[model samples]
Target: MSINELTKKLKNEAYSSLYLLYGKEKYILEYSQKLIVQAVLDEGSADFNLSSYDMEEQPIEAAIEDAETLPFMGDHRVVIIQNPYFLTGAKVKQKVEHDLKKLEQYLQNPSEQAIVIFIAPYEKLDERKKIVKALKKQGEVIQAEKMNVQLQKEWINHASKEANVKMTDEAVERLIELQGENLGLLIGEVNKMALYVGEGGVIEPSIVDELISRSLESNVFTMVEHVANRRIDAALRICYDLLKQNEESIKLMALLARQFRIILQVKQLKAQGFTEKKMASILSLHPYAVKIASRQSRAFSEEELKDLLIRAADADFEMKTGQRDKQLSLELFMTGIHKAKQTN
Candidate 1:
């Protein structure tokens, strides 16, 4: 099952006897766990019924025992078992031993009075294991993998609605730009923005611009945008600001080169009939990022991109060889871009 499906079940108060939640996305896994805990356990009796164990430090039998034991002063219990390394094909780093027979027995007759949640922070599980097979057959499984950008946007809209805050589509895109595609960080940013905007308030792009800290990667893109548009003054100003913050010119050059390289790749791929989704997967980039780069790449020809990359590489060589001052080389490179833009 996906996170969305699991969430629907939790909202409907559909509690399962055993849940096998595993994924590479930490946020999704943790969020699913929270939903399950909230749906099944009351706040007052949570302390007595809630139990967590690290499988790396303790044997699996201990958790099984906790799951089988009756709820304390409550009608049901929630047992959280973390880092079930036995489920994976990897070797365990710790000396702790797990009882496979005990776990297999517990899976066959899981307590009707308890909810056992096995949290595996792994990309894939050993599907061939009998224990894993039994759990899959007997328990509800939730794969908390990363959602695509469209799905993430849907979630953002849904989250804003739940927070009772109105958010425009532009605001949603801006939030994703500021925070990137990490759902966890984006969710936190949305929550903060919602609080600032208050109930029934609309979160605008301007509000996001004011609240979020622009990452260095974002700044580099902004600088490159200025260069692409022949806005030399703005580009130089951004460079100076970064220098004041102790950003090395060589490092900035490297970032600029990388950005241009990506744009070049995006342009070539687009020419080859690649969609943004396909480009993102091929380049291991966020779809939103690929979309932005695709638009930006259209502003320049392949020859122009290659020329800019060559300039960046030459500047790097000059800086390293001590033939030119690092800062001066960067400033000169910016000036060269301006001159090239005029000639075009």
Candidate 2:
């Protein structure tokens, strides 16, 4: 099932017997695990119902033995197998194939007082193995992996809507700016903002400014927009602000390089019979952002974009180890972008 499906199932009291959460992203899994723990145990006695099994040293049977036990005061036990290195190797599963065969039986007929939670990084799972296939079929598995910045925005907006608050456009943008691609961190920030604003919530930019410290994302995007508009002075000011915020010159060069790469992709896709929506899907970008980026790509020719990327790489190298002045190297990058804009 998808992550949203798992989340809805948890909310609807539709508890699965086994919850196997493996992913590039752990935040969603952790959120669902907490929901399970809360559903099975009261706030006061949650500690009693929650228990962990370490699989790095213990065999799979240790977890089975633990699952056989009952909850102390509640009707269910929240059993978590953490960092299970055993699930990764083929030989280990081969040696314990019979031992794991019983787990399917248990899943089919789980004890009334038990809920098993399995967590491992997705790359660690041996997908070809029998036990792996069986476990996938036996329970609801969630892949809670890392998403891009635009996905992070959707998550923030959805999370806000779930909490019964309307996030202003600027507010949502500010949240993305402060916390990039970390829903867990965004959740924390949202909680604080909700409490800080209280009822009749108005999540304005000022409120965001008061709550979240400005981050490198705002600086990065502002620099990009400034360059796009041919505001070299404003771009230089933002670069100084980045330097004042202790951002390394090489880091700025790297950010510029990444932006140029995206612009190149935008230009290429626009030429290759791709619509903006198709470009968004292919690049995993927000529709609005794809539109803006496509327009921005019109401001530079492909050859000019290529030269800018090369200049960015040279600036990165010079800023990192060359004997030239660091600020001067970054200034040269800004001027190059300006030159490229003029030529286009």
Candidate 3:
């Protein structure tokens, strides 16, 4: 089920007896867990009704037993079964033997008085297993996967509303540009920005520009973008700021090379008729990154990208081998790219 559907059901207090939450997105998985906990137990009953067991250290039967147990002074109990590796194809060293038969039997007729949630933080589950099959038939399976750019924007809006602030579209785009697609960082930044703006305030692009913290990698991306646009002075200013912040020149060179490499790959893939979505999937990058790289790739020829990469590599070697001052080498590289852009 989608997270929105789950939210709607939970909002109506329609609780499921069995829920299998599995995915690689920890933020969504964690958020979904919190929602379930809030929906299942009140603050007063949570301590007595909520039970968690790690399958790595405890057997599945223990969790099942808890699920079957009656709630303490409440109408429902929440039994969280964590790290049920047996549900997946992964080969984890067994510290305790799980009674799959007991689990299978419990799945057939789960307790109506309790909610059993399997928190499987895995990319995929072993669907071939009988227990997995039984669980699929018996429970609601919610896959907490990564959100696309649109979904991410929606999340930002929702979070901003919850904080009693409004985020402009430009502000949302800027936040993603600066912070990438890390939901955790985005939400934290959103909350902080909301507090600064106060209730009923609107967060604009300028507010994001002033308040958001740019990572080293993000700064490098901006620097390269400036280089692509032939804004050498702006690019150098960012580089100097990093130097002031005690960022090593060698590390900066490495990040520059990585960004250029991505641009080169995106350019080649685009030439091969691959869409941005396809490139994102192939490159294992966020779609927004692919979008930025695609736009940045347009400023340089494939030959120019290759030349920039070679120069970055040579500068890296020189700095690491002590053949040149690290900061000077990085500056020369930046200037060199700028000069190349000018001559073109």
Candidate 4:
């Protein structure tokens, strides 16, 4: 089932007998698990009804047996089976023997009075297995994956609505620019901003600029933009700010190199008639990031980008070899690039 379907079901107190929550997105996976528990049992009854087992150390039959049993004092029993590695194609040495037959039998006839949840934190499951096919047929499978740009914007809007505040489109865009696509951090920042704005208040771009902390990578991206625009003073100011925050010069240089590399790649790919989505897939980057890089790539020719990369490598070598002061080497690299742009 989709997350929205699960949310609607939980809203109406409609509980499912079997749930297979598997994903790489830890925040969504854990949050969904909590929501299920909250919907299945009250605070007082949770102590008696909720049971968790680790399949890594314990047998699957133990969890299946618990699921077969009735609740102690509640209407339903909730059994959480964690780290079911056998369901995947991984070759992990078993610490304990699991009765797959028992699990298969339980899936064929799950207890009506129990809610069994399988939490498999994996990218892909072994679909070839009969047990996996049976579970898919019998349970509600929720795949938690990373959200794309549009989905992320929708999530921000939903979060704002939940907080009883309104977020403008510009504000949402700025939040993504500052926070990147980490959903957990984005939600936390959204809640904090909501509290500041209070109920019935609108969140604007100015508020986002004032309240949200800029990540190092975001700062580096901004610095590169300043360089591209020939605003050397603004770029130097950002470098100083990061230095004041005790950011190592070597780390900053590495990020700078990475940013330049991305811009060059985006430029080359765009020249080849590649779409933004296709470029993101090839580069293993978010589409939004690719979009930004594509725009930035216009400010410099391919030759300039190649030169900057070489300079960055030379600066790195000098710093690591103790041939120059690390901070001085970074400053020189930036200023030298600025001068080269002006001369050209």
- Estimate the TM-score of every prediction: 0.89, 0.80, 0.90, 0.94
* Candidate with better TM-score, 2 vs 3: 3
Cα RMSD to the true fold for all candidates: 2.5, 4.0, 2.3, 1.7
Which one wins on lDDT?
4
Model 4 misplacement above 4 A? none
Runs of candidate 3 exceeding 4 Å displacement: 244-246, 272-275
For 1-344, candidate 3 gives per-residue lDDT tens digits of 98789989999988989999998878877888899999889999999999999999998888888888899999999999998899999988899999999999999999999999999999899999999999989988888776788878988998998899999999999999898778878988999999999999999999999999996768888898898898999999999999999988888999899999999999999999999999999999888778889999999999999999999999999999999999999999999998988889
Q: Write the per-residue lDDT of candidate 2 for residues 134-183, one digit (tens) a residue.
A: 67887778777667666677777777766667779888876776555567
Q: Rank the candidates by TM-score, best first.
A: 4, 3, 1, 2
User: How does each model score on lDDT?
Assistant: 0.89, 0.75, 0.91, 0.92
Question: What's the alpha carbon RMSD for model 1?
Answer: 2.5
**Candidate closest to the true structure, highest TM-score:** 4
Clashes in model 2: which pairs?
A: 25-145
Using lDDT as the yardstick, the better of models 2 and 4 is 4
